[model samples]
Target: MRTVLVLTVSLLLFSCSPDTDDERIGISGDSFLIFGHFFGECIGEGCVETFKLTESQLLEDTIDDYSGQQLNFEVLSDALYQQVRDLPDFFPLELLNEKEAVIGCPDCADGGGLFIVYSKNGTQQSWRIDQSKGNVPVYLHDFIDQVNARIALINQ
Candidate 1:
């Protein structure tokens, strides 16, 4: 009976551990993906964009089914890709809430944006920030700017 009980408890603990083998990209997997929308002033269910970064290349896509715009794929230059890969690391996972966090005033007339970072160790962090108020976290703001700059490079 004692042996059986100990085994059962061990099995339960292993089962309860967090699962990180899902379809979504992992943070420390040499592949970084950032996807979200611009809220409060977007056309056709918000302007949705997704970016995936890897050591050798960068892939980007923009989709708007409502507007009948098809998926557009853009590959950035090697130099630009390298710059993006080296973006300063910010937001130590410990300082941030593991789950989605929404900060700042509610009625600040801010053009809010949603961002998610899939980090190493199968960790994920997301935030909804008010961009207009300029009260965003320094790391978060810089990361966003870096992404937008990459987008511009592709468009140009």
Candidate 2:
């Protein structure tokens, strides 16, 4: 009986979910969200940067002269949004766990980056890659490259 009730509730929630075309929580349509921090070992000393991207806008915050400034852009196009939404599926959620134990260079400078994606219905997934360790995941690199390319195109 408990299992049946759980299934019934789950079905009701699914049925009540907004259409993929509806924009909610500032995310456009069924696109995903990206938000996280990229920091060096000295992050505690204002040496870190952060970014967030929804389907309709991109935001960046960086520490400059010990002051933080946030920049917002409305340049995320539909095509680019789709790419960002699909990028997270290639990563395993466990990638977000600290992997310092597997790092090959303990003496190397400690700087790593993490990116998170929140689906339309609020499911979350994230990945963290260490710069002082082995090769960072290629998919993350590709996603960053694509985002940069799109931003460049918009800037021009």
Candidate 3:
């Protein structure tokens, strides 16, 4: 009886643990997930526009139904906490207006965030937003939430 109970508890815990974060916020066909807020605003010519993403900002992208183990996490976060784990790191992120986080980090894709390397049948290669998002933990979370909301709208 004791062995059976312990096995059952262990199985439950393991099953609940997230191998990757692909369902927290906005989710698409690709195995991408977000978990925070997002806001974008700008002034073009004489017009001003603003957008905010809150509770509904969670987003997801699951490419070909691939998942955490298949994508591999250790390569990106370098044993960092779950908060920044398994993000892609594309080479010349600078061209995309990003920075190289560590030496010999190669490209962020296959590691950190989606690097477009894992593209679906006909998906766009990248996210081409205009604004820069500093690596503020709080801000990232909020942005994810806001993006999730947008994804939700698109689904409807």
Pick the TM-score winner: 1
Worst 10 residues of 1 by lDDT: 86-95
Pairs in clash, predicted candidate 2? none
Assess the local accuracy of residue 7 in candidate 3 as a C-alpha lDDT between 0 and 100: 98
Can you write out model 2's per-residue Cα lDDT over 76-123, one digit (the tens) per residue?
A: 455544444433434333344434423223223555444344555556
Q: Model 1, range 35-154, lDDT digits (tens) per residue?
A: 333444556533555555654666665553322234465786777667656432432333254343664532246454544444455554555554543665554555556555655564
Encode model 3's per-residue lDDT on 56-126: one tens digit a residue.
23223222122122221112222222323223221122322334322222122222221222233333233
lDDT of each: 0.51, 0.45, 0.30
Model 3, stretches more than 4 Å misplaced? 1-96, 100-136
lDDT at residue 100 of model 3 (Cα atoms):
30
lDDT at position 18, candidate 3: 66
Model 2 has a clash total of 0
**Order of candidates by lDDT, top first?**
1, 2, 3
Reference-based TM-score of each model: 0.49, 0.38, 0.20
